[model samples]
Target: MARCGSKACWFGLGMALGAVVGGACAMLVRTATQERVLRQRDAPMVPSDATADQALTVDATDVVEYRGFVIHVFCHALGMGRFKALCDIWESGAVVLEGGGPPTTHVTAEESRSAAIAWARQWVQRNG
Candidate 1:
């Protein structure tokens, strides 16, 4: 058998190591993301010890027109005075698409609304 000091040997070793490490990193990321989503989804929508005020200062949902489609955005409260967004895209009063963003909560309902609108705009550009 030949010696193990060739470039091919090192390349193979590097590739194998990279694959193992990459797989591990990807799994870790996926697990963490799932855990985060679960925690955020299951937690309280508002703080328990906070004063009795509305979670949102404005209406929870609104509809706007964009790119010849209707975009309905809803802001949902998260704990610690944060918010996330859910969106619905409609054409002819029937939904064409829908999505939600939870891991990206904002400090205000308006902010969440803006983020949802931006996301909807990009989605429209890409898929509509």
Candidate 2:
């Protein structure tokens, strides 16, 4: 112990410093990874302008008017078969069916243009 200026002392000090730096870097990387994953996975559940009290599903059928036009309204979640019926009615009746969506089918100009007009007018009056 008279003079402890050996190569072992320098190596030990360097090893300890390297371990501390590496541990800190690993922690930083882990935190950044977690944050990025959460940001990408956790999208907002509700619409931006919608309030907490707003209803999630609103059906247009409640106010739909089934007058002489035999009108049908296909909403956002309505299936393709129903949409097809609406399209058929449109093509056949050639009327003015109101409303459209991702796979929506509206009344065409064939079947009952007057009926479609009456249906739309009544629906808007009732719903709006």
Candidate 3:
């Protein structure tokens, strides 16, 4: 009976250790991937000299032509159920408006898009 008990204890201990090790490895990998992504995002973007039409073709999927300005909406993951929306408005191949929402817990991608479009429209009306 004692021998059986000892064997079960050893097995439980081994399983616990394995779980700990697996969790630590997963955390390390996630951290490394996040760092790499951050580095890539922070890299300097070369400004283009293209016309408005050319710029429209650059990012067709996320670009919106509003009042002769190109508005690009970028969604950034902030982890822990938070997200950020960045609105980059371009005119004549240069950034004319840069704005975004603060990290929020419940904002959806669609909401972010709407907010960006509203902001851009206001900016264009005021400055354009």
Candidate 4:
């Protein structure tokens, strides 16, 4: 019988290697895409007037003081005229609470600020 070291054997080996390499590349791409999405989600929605470090400035006109908490409303663009509202509540220069409202097409800066205030009030009323 002839030896099996023919072109067909090499072709099959090449195909198997190609499949393994392709699968590895696909898995790497999937992992990278998932990590990118997670980073975007965890990123803060910084407003245009925020400081360099994205810190809430007390002098900012958008900053609102409710009860003992200072609420900062940040609007982030979500493409297609949509927006995400983030409410960062601070006490003694430290963020004590963080919350957000439903993403909506309508501008919800004021609504987010109000919600933060209400949350702070309720928290105080319950804790005190």
Candidate 5:
């Protein structure tokens, strides 16, 4: 029969204990994270009255409407060429306009401005 040394036995025991400790630590971390998420979900929903009037934040964006006068909201850089080309080729008199800057939209200033003025007049007549 072979006899095991104290050092070898202690090393094997230490390795086994380390693996168990590591697994327990991993489980503990996962449970803590789940508990935190659950706590957040249980929190109360804030009432609308508690906040300021969100309606005051108006979206002053440009839009082009069609025969039905439906709003076609877009940005300012969608040039006359693409829209007009599309309409001319397709035989559709659809409106195409947008707000300021390159990123906002792609409507050309010349075409968009003309349309914008027309839009303003129409808006005033209808609203007034």
Candidate 6:
């Protein structure tokens, strides 16, 4: 039996206590990280034709030519419940107009894309 007053006995007790505390801390950290990952995984996801392994945030990016002006629109989910859209109008290889619509809690990226395109078309009609 180790004497309670011995340095070696106290050192061993300290080391054992440290190991137990360290192990408990590790378990807590691991559990917290797992819960965070699970929460993100369970969040609403953007549907796509692509495979699950190929996760894409930007669902639509397309270019359209109208009246010799090119309209470029890009759309993506802001938070899976909201969406954002940006647009550019180019003429003769120079960007003539650039803007973005306000983010909205829309369910689909297509809605944002169509709204951006409609805004661009209206601008072209008034200017062209």
Winning model by TM-score = 1
lDDT of 4 by residue, 10-111 (tens): 888889999999999999999999998988743555555445423222333256676677776665444323344556667889987665433443344345
Runs in model 4 deviating more than 4 A are 1-61, 77-81, 98-105, 108-128
Lowest summed lDDT window (length 10), candidate 4? 52-61
Using all chains and alpha carbons, the TM-scores for the candidates as numbered come to 0.56, 0.33, 0.45, 0.42, 0.30, 0.50
Pairs of residues at least 3 apart in sequence or in different chains that clash in candidate 1: none
Error of 3 at 19 (Å): 50
What does candidate 3's lDDT look like per residue over 1-128, in tens digits?
43436878989888999999999999999999999898863343333433422332334226688889888877543333334456778899998867543334234545655665677678777887
What's the lDDT for residue 34 in model 4?
94
Q: Write the per-residue lDDT of candidate 6 for residues 36-56, one digit (tens) a residue.
A: 888863354554643431322
lDDT string, candidate 5, 8-102, tens digits? 88788889999999999999999999998887732434434643322212332444443434343322222223221111100135433233222
Give every collision pair in model 6.
none
Ten residues in sequence with the least summed lDDT for candidate 1: 51-60
RMSD of each: 9.2, 15.2, 12.8, 7.0, 15.5, 7.5
Off by over 4 Å in 2: 1-4, 41-128
For residues 6-83, could you state the per-residue lDDT of candidate 2 as single tens digits? 899878878999999999999999999999988753232444455421321333232334434344532221222221
When 1 and 6 are scored with lDDT, the better candidate is: 1
lDDT at residue 50 of model 6 (Cα atoms): 38
Q: How far is 13's C-alpha from truth in model 3 (Å)? A: 59
Candidate 1 per-residue C-alpha lDDT over 10-95 given as tens digits, one digit per residue, 9 for 90 to 100: 89988999999999999999999999888755365556755532544345477889888888887766666677788888887788
Single out the weakest 10-residue window by summed lDDT for candidate 6: 51-60
Q: Runs in model 5 with CA error above 4 Å?
A: 1-4, 41-128
Better of 2 and 4 by TM-score: 4
